[model samples]
Target: MTTLDLDFVRSHFSAFNEPSLAGWSFFENAGGSYACNQVIDRLTNYYRKTKLQPFHPFPASEQAGREMDAAINNLAAYLNVDEDEIDLGPSTSQNTYVLAQAFLSIMQAGDEVIVTNQDHEANSGAWRRLTDRGIIVREWRVDPETGYLDIAKLDKLLNDKTRLVTFPHCSNIMAHVNPVAEISAKAHAVGAKVVVDGVSYAGHGFPDVDALGADVYLFSLYKTYGPHQGLMVVRKDTREALGSQGHFFNEGLVHKRLVPAGPDHAQVAASSGVTEYFDAVHAHHFGPQADASKRGPDIHDLFQAHEQVLMAPLLEYIRSRNDVRLLGPENPEERAPTISMITNRDGRSVAEDLSKHGIMAAGGHFYSHRLFQGLNLDPEAGALRVSFVHYTSPADIQKLLKAMDAVL
Candidate 1:
């Protein structure tokens, strides 16, 4: 296993701390991560110095606009795509809602869309809404026992009428990493465009949108150690086909067209901090082997490797406890670091017990209500979620394990 440099990780983020009675363990990285100091500083500085609207003719506004553009460009370059392919929105949920409306204009009433029960409501609900317009919606079911999305099941759902297929790259509740490329190919074979909800997976590491072969991919910046913003990457061809969702004046801008909401300039400027964190990690881990010229996918892979190593022990410890029933795949190879587990006792009760001990784990459906129901776990009786990121420490895992042992 590749080793993560604990000292370097601690140096980068001040949020890494031991469990305290007055504080929380912060195991909810899947929902949102604590913002990095670098991001906070950048945002503060921007607000203090300029406080002007971006893209104006004045020097201050122009410089601010340039900074915002640089941030978007950096993120796009990291994702291995052209700048035009990326659109910045206020939130992932908002982006999905807007994109769904855009699809309505392009797709005919008879067109079919495949949606999975394993996705958060953000991905499933928006597309499913198309049903009201006479669009056919196919359900990509999950295996109740194992919480796995069978590719065979997805195969049966596809046909010539399938115009779009939406699912999570990694489920927020189940944590299973979907076979994106394979699914993308299957959908494309049937003339359907693939849209992936990457909110849970993107924070663990950067994903190459083009390599995933997804026509459109969406994720949240807040969950990835950056600002509160949503990112959507659309293939150039798909963007052209979907048409714009914006006002008549902005119709010419393909990126703005899908996002009817005006861009949040400060939040967009703050997004560059995610790359800043990535750059710092890459330099620390790879040393000279890390090339500044390398794109987002390369740097992200390094962080993924490091995170995988750190998460292995925690997963193993959780598996060892007979009282705990782990959700999703049994092995780390088949899952992300977002581990959701149920105890013999009530999930919330266990979470409360842990809370008394300063463990900041959460217990709920996590908005993947259909997934919990499919797994035969009552959505009302939510499972305890203990998710982590690249910045998570070994000591933090140990603290969680100790809390779990006591609570369970």
Candidate 2:
């Protein structure tokens, strides 16, 4: 099997060689990754050459419209979803907020929606707020000790009245990869729709939405090393079921329906760069391929294999430490590269100390306050999160281990 070419991977991201960023090991990728040159070039070119009112009957406008359409089509192909099923919006928080409005129009009083504490506030708060409209918002809480969501608990919560179930593909803090297909299957059996927040998971690999079987899937492009846009896929049946949130004229357009705010043409156009980066990776390892869908899994496995190797030593180190509590599974195979730890010392101070040695990481509740409270962690103190992606090298991990030793 072909392995990931790390040299080929790091070369695509200009940030690695920046004068000010030299020698700095970036582990805050879950917050947002350093964009690849493909994204930067596309974004910059869009602004310079094709900045115009897209879809208009003119030269620049036509080019702008084509670029935006290519972005959606290419990305949709990679996910194995129809282009019409995809919606690009400002951010994941904004996308879910708008989507909640559509759900509100359909859900009747006494109907239940289950949300997980393991989710970021972007996914949890929006659905929970629907309780104001008389919908019964139920909490599918995570295990207080392990920070893992139990499907058995979810099974108890689902019933005839359960209209929707919202959870993460993986938690930003816990990093445990959820069984999205299995969870979606259970929800489907209960006649409920599954809304997946893929922001954390997509940084490791973009999912095959069709196979995952979610009614609605969402991820942020910025965190995926693309533009700052939220990409959502609403299955055809789910799109038709929800009331339109867009303007009256766009009611019949599946892509336009949930986006109340008009699309950002330039950013949408630049998003094609994400697929460009993926294609480059696929070609470098496995040779040129015309099929984006086929390439998706191959590339995903390659990246995950590389990440797991780098993640193993870090997981072992965290498990051996008695001074801090590791948040999720100690095995790297069970999670993404996003690792969190709660310490006796202040998390923020530890993060600051790590920064002095040029290790870029973050410390916070990460907007999952309810999850923190459930885990018996002080939300005010939060926890230290050290996350990375495929571009991260073994040498970088060594620097992080040394910095962590000195700081903690």
Clashes of each: 1, 0
Model 1 over residues 100-144: C-alpha lDDT tens digits? 988887798899999999999999999999999989998999998
Give TM per candidate.
Answer: 0.95, 0.99
Most TM-score-accurate candidate: 2
Segments in model 1 whose C-alpha atoms lie over 4 Å from true places: 17-23, 288-295
Q: Roughly what TM-score does model 1 have, to 2 decimal places?
A: 0.95
The CA lDDT of each predicted structure is 0.84, 0.92
Clashing pairs in 2: none
* lDDT score for residue 314 of model 1: 78
Task: Choose the strongest candidate by lDDT.
Answer: 2
CA error at residue 311 for candidate 1, angstroms? 3.0
Once model 2 is optimally superposed onto the true structure by TM-score, how far is the C-alpha of residue 325 displaced, in angstroms?
A: 1.3
lDDT per residue (tens digit) for residues 240-263 in model 2: 989988899988877789988889
